[model samples]
Target: MPLSEHEQRMLEQMERALYAEDPKFATALEGSGLRVHTRRRVYQAVAGFLVGIALLMTGMVAKQILVGVVGFLVMLGCAVLAVTGWRKAGKPGEAQAQPSAGSGSRRQGRRKRSVMNRIEDRWQRRRDEQQ
Candidate 1:
């Protein structure tokens, strides 16, 4: 769904505020170049997983429990890295931008609200009172 006019205006205002507060960060975020980094991470993870498998097989043949355990741990870490990289890479730009843009929005309906959410709430309440 598209943002309503009011929401769009609010978003614009928030963006301006962000830029004003930290121009350096705002500029740094432009043209993030994340895709290449993500791809590299994925490749590294795959390589690590393959190496771990080889180590695991060698340990099993040698009957070295410590080596096998280390190999298992390495495999687990590599699997986690690959999964996270894939997940992040698959997300659209909007989904990634939303959280950073509106750090105020409740996350997955969690009970603990972010500081920005509280600030926005206060601002809203003040606006309502003035009206």
Candidate 2:
């Protein structure tokens, strides 16, 4: 159903509020779905996977083990590429896999440590409960 006038106005107000509170986040969210490269990458990945499957079938029919192995590897790589592309597609404006000259690496390392610590703590708690 279409939103009522009051609901539309309320949504507009909320959007404005969100933008005012965190313009970067609002902009990122707005632009998340506008990545042409990501869509292309996904399409390429699908094509790569299909080509790999065809190569594998041909190799099997021709009794070429090396060709079949190469095709399997290509298929695996394409599958991983597609998954990563999908995950990163929502944040197209982000930089590539390079750390900035400043504290970017440190911040990422800290984030990783925090995540690992949380996982370790969870495991420890489970172990303690079991004991």
Candidate 3:
């Protein structure tokens, strides 16, 4: 459900007042909840990876094949989780700044032309300098 207009206005006013009262504190708290949650997940995955490593080493010293296999699987799963979480977390403002679906191809076209134009300009400059 969406907030009523009056509630939104009140919330905005409170945010503004908080910023005015302590800009630094407000900035420190500005990270989105999703970003924080994903970061926490990544951290947990890393810790789990470390635990897996310890388990693998213990299994090796004890000559236990099953324990070693389980440890390897745990490490692999944690690594995958860490990678996915990191990808999802991206830069804090990246999701907010993304272009809409309709504009993606158009933006890519402009980017390609700009890159080609730069290369052409560099080639022309090199030719002129060699003359």
The candidate, 2 or 3, that scores higher on lDDT is: 3
**How many pairs of residues collide in model 3?**
0
lDDT of 2 by residue, 1-131 (tens): 23434555898899999999999999887744546678789889989999999889989999999999889989999999999887666555573332233545887877866676677667767877999
Error of 3 at 117 (Å): 25
**Model with the higher lDDT, candidate 1 or 2:** 2
Q: Candidate 2 — which pairs collide?
A: none
Q: Kindly give the stretch of ten consecutive residues in candidate 1 with the minimal lDDT sum.
A: 93-102
Off by over 4 Å in 1: 1-32, 91-131
Ranked candidates (TM-score, high to low): 1, 3, 2
Pick the winner on TM-score between candidates 1 and 3: 1
Give the winner by TM-score.
1
lDDT of 1 by residue, 1-131 (tens): 33434677998898899899999997677544686688689889999999999889889999998888888989999999999998676554433443343346556434343455676667778878999
> In candidate 1, which residue pairs get closer than 3 Å at backbone N, Cα or C atoms, i.e. clash?
none
Model 2 quality (TM-score): 0.46
- Report per-prediction Cα RMSD to one decimal: 8.2, 15.9, 15.5
